[model samples]
Target: MKKLQLSLLLMVFLVMAGCSQSETTNTEVNKLKETNKTLIEDYNKLVDKKEKLEMELDTYKEVDENSKHLTTIIDDFIHAAQKGDTATMQANISKEFTFEKQEEWLTAVNGEKNFPFYSDFYKTKLKSWYLQGIDYDKEKDFVRVFARVGYSDGEDSWYFEIIKEDGYFKISDLQYET
Candidate 1:
């Protein structure tokens, strides 16, 4: 009887030990599952952030390309004016192109009537000229180009407003800083 009692106690201890170990393993498994869930959530958030950044990058690229193209147009317009090429200037300018100063606006009836004066003004008045930069207002569909114009008196900055019309960019208005 004594031996049987000892054996039963040993068996009970072994079963209790087994149960304790199983409970510990289950707890560890639950913690691991929770950690995995949190990691997956973090990964998803990172993926979303990456996608957003990529889209922003694409938008910037498009804007940069547009700015570059507009800059080229401005350069070509200037070159045409310098060469006294009325046809090129007329082609690049909007039909509604206007000269704006202070609060006053002036428009020509047509390019042929107006370009000669502009050609003379640029050639004689502006001793030297260069493009500084170009910016776009997407909502307004307007491009503002900054230029440094050198005159006999001094140098001045000018803003040229370019607008999109009929799927082409055209110089709409020119403004000089006072």
Candidate 2:
């Protein structure tokens, strides 16, 4: 009887040890799952942040691409006008170019109206155009330029706009502002 009781006690102890080990394993598995979940969440947040940063960078590039160099176009306009080269002017004007007649266009450059006001203005003979400025509007698909022309009298600023065509640039508009 004594031996039988000892055997029974040993069996109970062994069962208890087995149960404890099983519980420990379950706890460890739960911990690993929780760690994996947290890591996944962190990775998702980082991806979102990276996407936002990329968008902001793209915005900056668009603004830069469309926003500089009015002078170059203006120079083109002056040269075209002085040489009376309609082809050269067309090269810088929008295809659907709109303004009054050429006279009205010239008047604007002279700042005869809403155009800016500057004293000592003179028309360039347009022997050769030199770029003075360039400006663009990214959203509008248009660009403006400023140029110096060699007029019979002297040099002056001429502004013109280029229209976007078939993923290319063309002269479609012209104006002169002081």
Candidate 3:
């Protein structure tokens, strides 16, 4: 009878230990599920943040492709103008511009007496120039670009009219504020 009692006690102890281990396993599983849920939530938030950043980056581009191209052309033209490079300037201008201002456009660096209407452009060296804005004239079918040029004398407003020719943009006319 003593041996039987000893066996029963051992079995009871084993069963209780097994129940305790099972409870501990269930708690560990719950903790792992919570950790996985937290990781997923964090990942989703990061994705949302990334998407927002991309959209903000797009908004920073104020100029479209066409306008951007026009800006580049104007910048190049200004650089050429500073050096009185008639060839480079003419390359950016339209044939009509060349035809309209034939003598002045071709012989801007000839002499003081024969200087172009904007003689100061070829005489006084410029400091800097900045693009103010660009607007499209729907009815006129042209893009009007405004800029400010700073020279040794002072600042002047510059206007450039860009027109589409042969599927490309060209300077139809350009003048400065007197």
Candidate 4:
């Protein structure tokens, strides 16, 4: 009877041990599944962020390119003006040119009487030009630039109206202000 009782106790112990081990394994498997799900979610979020960053980078590149091109246009205009390349200057000027001192300049060139020193004016008054601002629309072929004309004694601000005609950029008009 003792032997039989001992064997029955050993059998019960073995069965309980097996059940506990199985439960532990099931819990570990569930934990692994949950970890895998979290990892997958995190991976997806990273991919989404990467894609958004790439899109933003592309947009920035485009904007940078446009800005560089606009700067080039401004530089070219300033170069032309500083060199007094009339052909180039006239090409870019709007159809009409306006100046607060337009009549004075014209009258000086026209040899009008009492128009203040004539030949000396042309030799000393016209000086360098500086580009102050440039703006353009990507969809439109027009760019507006603000420039400062440096003379012997003072600087004057002018606006250059730019447009693309027949695949060439030209200044359509010149305005003293506004």
Error of 3 at 123 (Å): 4.2
Q: How would you encode candidate 1's per-residue C-alpha lDDT over 41-159 as one tens digit per residue?
A: 99999999999779767755665778877777777776565455557766877876433222221223333333222433333454777889777665565778998867667776767
- How many residue pairs in model 4 have overlapping backbones? 6
Task: State the lDDT of candidate 3 residue by residue for 24-112, as single tens digits.
Answer: 99999999999999999999999999997786554334235567789888988877776656677777777564422444453332222
Candidate 1 differs from the real structure by a C-alpha RMSD in angstroms, to one decimal, of: 7.0
Q: Pick the candidate with the highest TM-score.
A: 1
* TM-scores, one per candidate: 0.54, 0.42, 0.52, 0.43
Which candidate achieves the best lDDT against the true structure? Answer: 3
TM-score of 2: 0.42
Task: Please report, as a residue range, the 10-residue window in candidate 4 with the lowest summed lDDT.
Answer: 107-116
Please give, for residues 1-178, the per-residue lDDT of candidate 4 as tens digits.
9999999999999999999999999999999999999999999999999997797666556545565554555556555554454455445444344222343342112223211212224654556766687665445545677877677767767775567556655556445431
Clash-forming residue pairs, model 1: none
Candidate 3's displacement at residue 158, Å, is 0.6
